[model samples]
Target: MNQNEAVQQNSKPRRVSKKKGKALNNPPVKRLLLPTVVYLIIATQIPFIVTIYYSFQEWNLMRPDKGVTFTWFTNFIKALSAPSFYEVAMNTLILTTSVLMICFVCGLLLALLMNRNFVGKGIVRTMFISPFFVMPTVSGIIWKTMVYNPSFGFSAYFANVFGVAPYDWFTQNPLLAVIFIISWMWIPFFMLILLAGLQSLPMELIEAAQLDGANRLQQFFNVTIPHLVRYIEVVVLLGLMFILQVFGEIYVTTSGGPGFASTNLSFLVYRTGFQSWDVGGASAIGVITVILTIVMMLLMFKVLRRMFKEEQA
Candidate 1:
């Protein structure tokens, strides 16, 4: 065979191999991902766009005769100008913050406890996680009637034993009641995440810290906490997102009363659109809520990232 003919044969095999390599590397990834991307945009973004469109128009279901009219920013202005808006905003902040803090502390403690070996540990962990599996509305009802009820409930029974009046939780402390109920439901979620982080932690580090004259608290604060920083960030951010949108607990327990005392932005949207029949106002409030959530999450992410960098440093 001629040298050129042999070289051409080798070159052809190399070219074929290159094509195979490229196919493996690319793997039709875009084709596989396009359906999911399209699905998400249709499910989430399209509705949001429709909401934004409606927010710019005045549409009251009660006054269908007047029909929808483009009023630019009037709906936003009206929604923002309402006195209850600020109160509801504050309630949302307070509820989310309180729940996140409560759940974090409780979850960390539970995770620490669960990380230890003990008899029936699996059963104990299952019991702890059971609340998270319960439906939100069911959890609300359970707390409202079984735990927080002023009469013939745990509160009343305990109050009787203590020789004090059963506190009307939903009436006098509606926001607090909502906070407690939400914390109860979400604490397990944080526990599972934090527990996973704890389990993944290297025991050698703890032993090394101990050899260096570190106590349990010192090791936890210095070694364990720093190690679990990423997990903590994930738990806090996820908790913030879900807790901020809390509606079921408030609805079942306080009904956003006494007179909007326990109402958060989510419940406010429901009340606006459903009760008041003001679609434009509700859409505007929803848009404001989405904006606020995005801003808050971005700020939080920046802070967490900075903290993570510091931990790495």
Candidate 2:
């Protein structure tokens, strides 16, 4: 054989190298996600665990020397047996349920109205959404001092017009007053969510309903609302979480009274932890609040899942 032919025959087979994946899947990717995981654990998870632990103990800032030794549900039992606890629970549920209803109905109305072609659509939408931006503390004080104060508020002005007594807001009706303030603050959020949901819905369905002899009310009930059911449910769930945990409003307006009238569970926790200085009971309430929020979120997720499944099937 020629030398050139021998060299060609001795040539090694070509080996192909596999492509490396585009993204790293190990510590680098995890390094990016790790901060968030760490934050969640530190900011939320660990504190929650500590709260649960403290719930079963008896500790007050007044007596730090006294370690938070476990008392095994004594605080929980005491909370239950407190007469005001029952009243406050009822008031809390009422505030949660009523304000949610008001927000839903009024918000849906405002959202539907804004969905129509209006000259000042942008302004109206902004106005509707503005209240949600107000922090709870600011909103609470604003309502208490500016809007509901019998001496200087709109109520007082109107009372003068009619030559009637200037009725006190928080003093006379604490539950209703707090509910109105909270509802006012939260309605904007509801409106924005529902309005977005309504806008995203297919117009063809609405037109089809109209063509099928459905009047305005009929179309709204049969078409628009059915499309918004999940959105509304989610909104209500979120609102319930907020309302159940309302404290700033109670603090600013009623201070949990005229007599525990506006004292929701959150305020009860605050009162116990700070005013009465019972950290253990406060921790128990915190644990309960977390559980309530979790349970509500779970229920809402189930509802959304069922809705999704029905849509898919």
Candidate 3:
């Protein structure tokens, strides 16, 4: 080829490459996306930063006359040593663990049942999922007034018909009562997720298992549960995130009351900040809670990662 023609050909390709690169740059999407990122950072991080700052200082709104003081580590130490701290921690552990266990097991069973082709399946599924849509506050109030109330509730009426007094569930077994309420509210959530997982499972693999003389139970244990590890992990992590912040139910039903019987970390923080007006102490608790939650998430992610690797292998 002539030198001038070759140069023109090379220059044309470069021009086209530049045009393609320009077309790939999505400035409008970036412009819309970056502001959202900035807004989220500002909205979430500012309060977190403020809480951390106050955690190191002594500021009790209730005792303003005593004046604000910078007390490093005192609030943390006090929170640790407080007589009710351990009770609150235990309550938190029990509440989270019990609710998760109940929800997971019940959810799996319900998902399995719903997976089958049966009459009225649509109605059953709609009814099963309805509770999950109810607001937590409303759920708590319904349980408190319509179910558990000893004076004029369903249980009371039933007991009256049998000539026996209704047992006061909240007063007698506060933690268990809270667990039941929370579990009822959360089970359908897990059920929906697990049902989706079950439906998405490969039918060919299931048929192969059946051909290999694997019964339903064996296939479920060996094939189904293994396939659902990732889904379970998703449910667990999301459940923990929401469960750790449980407040409305406790607020409506127990008020963390009759002592620290049902008071978890979140309730304790609320009580400290708003009720007791110990802003610094509450901030310290909030910081500790954030740390604990982060640590828990990291551990769970590590375990799930290992499980994922094993499944792949």
Candidate 4:
């Protein structure tokens, strides 16, 4: 009996080792993973390769007889040097920054408000979330037609009540109009993330803070803000990424301008490729935008990593 027990103990390690070996060399997992990886590579690489190839060649759809000529860095140089590019870049920055700031503040406030138990809380939360579920094109149209239209719209109706003339929002402040529409749509998304973070806070910590004579504002600044740093980082980075590619709202509402007043980098790319028929230049712009986005993400990741390390330390 003692010899049999010794053999059983000895066999356990061997069995575990065999299982580990099988896990490492699992045929089914390898088969599944290999095709998924190949599919991703093909899907991403094909468009990227095509875009890079086109960026160095001059190709105008309107003048196909001219033929595609290799211009090397000419398209990139032209896109960078164009005066309108600066305006569009600046507009993009302004729109993204404005929307992020407004949405973050409003979303945080709403999240804090909703964290408390209140009557009709479910209904209010549902209403808040509804805007985010609306299609972007439909949202843009609704804002343009129902809210911002100078004539026979909500703005005009409100103006009559207040004894003021109706203002054409898109014409006078196209960027602001677009920003407002986007912020309204995205605030709910931010709120949901922030509310989840708020809900996850340990009640003991909050109660302890209150017992230590921390008022609501002090507790918020001292306790709440520290706990939410990671969540805030997520919201900002993802929000910036999506906002940089804002096109539908601009396309539907402003069409990049009365005169390039609201044109962002994405909209500029669209206009260059389709409207100007300069595929090479548009491709160059597209590549540059992708590179810039990658650089920004890298910087953000590095900063966040350092912050996390410091916190851990």
Task: Give the best candidate by TM-score.
Answer: 1
Which of the two candidates, 2 or 4, achieves a greater TM-score against the reference?
4
Instruction: Write one digit per residue (lDDT tens) for candidate 4, span 138-225.
Output: 8999999999988877998999899998988999999999999999999998998999899999998889999999998999999999
Candidate 3, residues 107-199, lDDT tens digits: the string is 999999899999998899999999888998999999999989999988898999999979898889999999999999889999999999999
* Candidate number with the higher TM-score (1 or 4): 1
For each candidate in turn, the TM-score is: 0.89, 0.85, 0.88, 0.88
2 or 4, which is superior by lDDT?
Answer: 4
lDDT of all predictions, in order shown? 0.90, 0.83, 0.89, 0.89
The regions of model 2 sitting more than 4 angstroms off are 1-18, 22-32, 64-68, 307-313
Model 3 misplaced regions, further than 4 Å: 1-32, 161-164, 303-313
* Residue lDDT tens for model 1, 48-111: 9999999999999999999999999999899889899999999999988888999999999999
Task: Evaluate residue 294 in candidate 4 and report its C-alpha lDDT on the 0 to 100 scale.
Answer: 76
User: What RMSD, rounded to one decimal, does every model reach?
Assistant: 7.7, 10.7, 7.6, 6.4
Error of 2 at 249 (Å): 1.8
Off by over 4 Å in 4: 1-29, 303-313
Provide the lowest-lDDT 10-residue window in model 1: 11-20
